[model samples]
Target: MTGAAIGGGLVVAWWFLPREYPNPLTPARGEHVLGAWLKIAEDGVVSVAVPQLEMGQGITTLIPQIVAEELGADWRQIAVEPAAAAPAYPNTPLAKRWISLWDPATAGLSGGVDDMLAERFATSNAFTATADGTSLAAYEQPAREAAAAARAMLAMEAADRWNASWEECEVYAGLVRLGDRRASFGELAAGAAGQSPPDPPPLRPELADETPQAGSSEADAGPAASFPRIDLPSKVDGSYRFAGDVRLPGMVFAAIRHGPNNGSELTGFNVERAQGIGGIVGAVKTKRWLAVAATTWWSAERALRAMEPQFKTQYPVSSEDIGARLDTLLTAGDSFKTHETGFGEEAMARVDMARRYEVDPFHAAPVETASAAARLSDGRLELWIATQAPEQTRAAAAKAVGLGIEDVALYPMAAGGSFDARLENDHAIEVAHIAKELGRPVHLTWSRREEMIRSRPYAPVYTLVGAQLAGEGEAEGGGAIDALKIRAATPPSTHEFGRRLFGNLTPWAAIRETTGMKDELAMEGMVPPYALPSVTVRHVPVETGYPSGRVRGNAYVAGTFAIESFVDEVAAQSGREPLSYRMSMLGSDVRLAACLQRAASLAEWDGGLDQSGQGLACLRIGDKETGGRIACVATARQGEGGLRVSRLTAAVDIGRIINLDIARQQIEGGLLFGLGIALGSPLAVRGGLPASFEYADLNLPKLGDCPEIVVDFLPRTDGTAAAGFDPGELGVGVVSPAIANALFSATGLRLRRLPLLSGGL
Candidate 1:
């Protein structure tokens, strides 16, 4: 990979190489791990091919933009593909997602998504990843920085060709143009490739610096505010190749009929019956399931349909059994108050006078989750995974297959309906292991029933909360809340909060800790946007048989409902108008004010004056500085047998509006997610398995559920660009709170539990 000394005549090569491996976790340097990649092709496309399969969430759109920013190539000409699991690629997501999962504090305070954070790490050659260099924290910046540096190198090359200073040569939309002399990136590829890769690449500017939809070409020497998302068109048109579309000469397909029970391993299989069918390649048994391989998916289906295998039941799960268990769990008293305060003798004196009520909202639905891929090769494994943790599977698969990480190439394609369940990579890792053992191109997609049966699902949550009236001027009502605490981490974060109001239910420190705990305390309580004299929140971390990981908003779902509903409880007791109560509590928070005004306008919230009903939920995502801040207002109407969300409006004070359209899209998506979960979202489970095998039982939000989504984003005038993720989704998350609040306004039900307690079926 040598480069010439000539300025404009420089040349570079992005070579595709497999990673060497001993242990798959952290490969030696110069080996691909997962997220990171280094490729030198014949063209100037110095590539950093990732092994992490993109399962939507703008993965395809975001990565290419970063590469173009780094490679200085025309964004249109850049091509990015999933790297194979190897020491070279490491099979991790930019090496940064891992780190972010490990420690979120290093992600910084602001909602900034910097691509440089990922680039600072070494090649995917290591197994033990760091948060700063290999975590999800740098997901936004590392690649962007790398792309910008490549552009700088290319600009220098072009400047040399024109016999001018590099400053005179500008990169415009993958082109080198100086006055009348201009050439596309493709034309200057050879010259740019001839130069050695530069160190310490520059990052793109903040959103305040660049216009939306403008490619890097618009930048003045430096990386632009936003790189052109080259994959946008392909993904939009459904033209991009996904893993499901992979084709090999001798590739075959397979299907499995597994017991609908977790931990139900293989018992036995009858190959004679399967062998009687035509095109029945073979039947492999594992615990309680039989995997049949055939020339086509049809043949595999027919063989399985032709014969039913017998199995010994190990805790055989039925729909009825699951429902009974869930009901029992739900009926049980919530262990204890996650955030209980004013409980001492003096405080108890006041509790005797305050009116008390219980609000137990549970968002329960059955979701069938499946992740499977077709196996085409054995020595070199290719996986199609349905997971957000793409890198984890790639590395884990390589290790599981007794192959170096590079021997496994994971190509992420389109995915089935996904949620937080996609973050765990066990589905991919399991399929990869089974496919290789067969020595055939095996397709292992789960059945609708299988998805529900063998679920690594989020446990059903139940919460109990109690509050009392304040005595005299002693922080009456929900005063300042003193401090907001949250304890949402792995076991390492248990007891992170002392016995304080804030530290009880919403333990804030645990979230920032290194422990992998997903706060059990916040199963339904989170940060409140409402201001009081003193506010505090905390959580009690608990690790159960099913470690509740990224289960639908982590703490957002439970916490929002708990916090917002509790606020309403206070409002009801005081007989104060809900809107007025919230406003008074918020005081003068700028961002909250913006969201309230917009939402109120959308719903015509006139202090309970008109025919319209108003509901609002405050979002306190990021701090003022880290950006990505937002506020949302949601208004809904209850009709016969259905709830109509007439209007939902959001005013996001995040990232200074890099692209209003994109920001709005993100918010809308989040709304659908949160609203649907609030309404009739997933299927139900009885014993530990999903009762609903398909969408029919687990209904999603229909087109009718779509309300007018009015988005208002804060421009750079407020501050520089901030984090984009929270701002995008916070609006969607809390729409339910707003709707519930509105319902309380209209019906005076004051329902507190989720799947909101209703009168009608």
Candidate 2:
């Protein structure tokens, strides 16, 4: 891996080059690679290999948009196929090879990049990009290049046939035209088949000597723009394929019975009763798990229930116990201060006023429970799964089946929903294990209760916000914010994930422990956007028994809720309006200040306050990890039920917006997600398990409870932030803080902890 400092941050580039992988899009004619990611069929149906998983965030739609934009193909004609589980689909070449620099000024603004040629890192065929809010930022450029590569070939072929210069031909809407001559991309593709393709453009156009990259910025010019999502029609018609919808010729249903506690080893099980059960094929047993296979799913479920498996708990930890321990750590002051600046603890010591805020642990409940289908045929393994990380699924399934990566093929299925769910690949492994053992195709689906119990929930947070004001009108640096310190006691999801993924390797663990670096996912929103002179931010890592992962904004939602709410408090103390006070401290951060101002104005912040205890709040979302800007203003009222968000207005600057409909929808979806967590979705830990293990107990927000949201895009004319957008998780950061701020304005009663009113519930 190599890291390059570009723009304001480092962009990590992986050493792994894009390799040719079998194309699943057109399997009948065998796979043909066109610049790693692009594969042109003889029929002229341009198939672009997409690395990112589509979990209904419109990634699959946006990816095709970029390709169609560059390829000049009709959006309808282009097929957006899921890239197989191979080296071709990792994260992004830019992120893999470059360590993005964290810009402080923009850290508060969520600014986009400007020069694409200067920043486009490793371009490979590997569809190696994680699916998150930043999917657009991570995959857009590569998608552009892949489409352009195939288009270039078509243009070259057209130019050759017309006896004209390649530059004289233009590709548009699936046709190549030169002077009076014209040919469809399908015609050109057919002619170019079996013929030597045109040479690929240089990876970096500015430096011809540089190795050819897949998504070169220079080759990204085209006229493709927004189009209706391609996947929606099938989804609406119920023809879209999910893992649960998969069927194989000789498929057998398998049901799993995991240990009471995650990671517990299986002790023993009585399978005699289960075997005698009608339709029961057999039972596969492992030290850590057990599964029953049968001719039908109902029978498998029944047989699995009958085989009372015993599991030896490795640890006597419960959810309540973890909560109690976290409380102790919060008070102990023996935690690692992950981030510190200015006077650090000294500033907090001098504070005259302080407030403590806490957000309890929460679970993100996706409607779909885990499901997978796997088959071992002719010494080759195949799997169908709904996953956000398909490459990881492929790798895990291969590892579980004891097969080489090439022997295992993963057919990506459209997920019903994903909130950065943990065990995104766990269900695949389970299905693979059962199928390999039984020597028959196996389909496995986790029960809704199982999904709830095994959910990778958001960690509980304890935050202390302290500020010392300099006598009235004597604010520090002419800003309302004086000496400030934010101490957060958060369950370390990254630490836990690292231990789980690499704990068995002592050498890797030693290196990780010595480095003491937390994963970016864990610290998503830890950084403060404000310009506090004597600021100090500390993170105390606490362990939670269950696994945790990114669900929307992750720490950003939790941390930002505290910080933004604190900012509101400081503004109130300084005798200033929340919006004005925040803008005053923003200083030179024009982008963020602009967004806040825009959202406030659009929200009519001053027109009419919610007399029913209405409050207002703002959120800034542009950081090293997510390369975009989105400012949100939300209003809430104390209703009989709880905090009811009446309206939400967001000013977004995710550079260039792709599909306006999808972008807005993603932001809206994010707001609903944050509201769900703020209003409900609290995970109660009791007896080493989440007490709210099902929908009935989780209290998920429904459509009827959703607030009317308005999303406005900031004026943008093709710039840095335009190159990529992180709309998928954009609503997560702003919703919690905005709602919290609104709640305060309406009720004057500061409900700091998550679920807004933990006590009321």
Write one digit per residue (lDDT tens) for candidate 1, span 1-761: 22533443342122223334442233233322222433334433434554444444444445555465445455545556554434433323433433343334464333334233333332443322211112223344555554566566667777887888766767756577889988665455556645554566545453222322222221122234444455567768978755456666566677777654434455554556666667766666665467677787778876776667555543544434533443444334123333332222233222222221222222222243454674636378887665545545566677767888667776655553355445445456556666776776666665566655544444334333334444334236433233333222212221222111112221222323313343433433355555543333333233322222334444566567666766666665555566666766666576566556655665566664233466667666544445344445566677885667777766555543333334455677777777776665444444434555665554557787677877655444444344343343465457667777776666666665455642342
Q: Model 2, residue 521: what's the lDDT?
A: 44
Where in model 1 is the C-alpha error above 4 Å? 1-53, 66-80, 83-137, 197-237, 268-276, 309-378, 404-406, 414-417, 471-525, 531-549, 608-611, 681-683, 721-728, 757-761
Give Cα-based local distance difference scores for all models: 0.50, 0.66
Least well predicted 10-residue stretch by lDDT in candidate 2: 204-213
For every candidate, C-alpha RMSD to the true structure in Å: 9.8, 7.4
Write the residue-wise lDDT of candidate 2 on 206-259 in tens digits: 110111122332213223254788888899999988889999998888877776
